[model samples]
Target: MGIEGLVAKGAGTRYVGGRRDWQKIRHRHSREIIVGGVLGPITRPDAVIAGQYDAGGNLIIVGRTGTLSPSQSAQLATLLSPAQAGHSWPDEISAYPWSGRDAARPLTKVEPNVVVEVAVDTATQGRQSRHLMRYLRIRPDLTPADVDQLQL
Candidate 1:
């Protein structure tokens, strides 16, 4: 079977309406993506939106990182400059599902130079993460091109 393993519960424990007595731990996935943009104010960002290049050399929107720490936000501010004219993924940003129906805040696009490793639980439409990814760390050694070489 493709299943990695299984979890077991107590023999007499019956399914209750409240929280389950047993817990199942599933494998979580992680990937490295390029920092393409950010949501919320530029100085103190809410999340680190990221992307990766496909085989065709198109920068595909992958996902955004979870809420950043004050230090992390300040550090990112130093590395990320405002995207120049004719930024890539304009349409993608406008149509991004995570923005929600009543999104008022505009996304601040950053140069896709910074690379970060993030942990994701699920993916949507095989393109982006199903939810905001957990930010692991910034990768100074890796470039955006390195994302294509990754096995994931």
Candidate 2:
């Protein structure tokens, strides 16, 4: 199920503030995504804008990574470069669409060739994850073509 998790409640149980009376039991999923674009600079990305190719061979924005650790940033820097002309994605994207925030910022388009791993909850809106994602590591052994394409 594409649900966050299951909650098991005791019969006739009264709600408590912080007693672990009910278990959230969130489901975290690890997935492989293409590095489409990024926040901050090409040399040191603050976060990653992940993507997955739909059945139409079009890249769909999937999710955003939380702030990158210095080590992660450095590792990504070695793999990413400025997207060439006629890139599949735009130069920037509105934050409001995915972030639910008022401020929109510029996104640095990347080559869309790097494949990396990320951790996300089961919360998804359309083709995109609706929650913050954790960047796990670069999958150097895998290519973008090896990433799973969306069913669409």
TM values, all candidates: 0.75, 0.85
Q: Could you give candidate 2's per-residue lDDT for residues 1-152 as a string of tens digits?
A: 76698788988997888687886767898989999999999999999999998888888898899899999999999999888887787667777655688677788999999999999888877878877789999999999999998865
CA lDDT, every model vs. true structure:
0.73, 0.88
User: Lowest lDDT 10-mer window, candidate 1?
Assistant: 91-100
Clash totals for all candidate models: 0, 0
Candidate 1 local distance difference test against the native: 0.73
Q: Which parts of model 2 have CA positions greater than 4 angstroms off?
A: 7-23
- Model 2 — which ten-residue stretch has the worst lDDT? 90-99
Those runs of model 1 whose alpha carbons end farther than 4 Å from true positions after fitting are 1-11, 14-24, 91-105, 149-152
Cα lDDT tens digits for candidate 1, 1-152: 23423566899887777777777654467778888888766677778877887767767777777689888888877888888877776633542455455444467888788998888765364677656788888889988878764224
Question: Can you give the lDDT of residue 99 in candidate 2?
Answer: 66
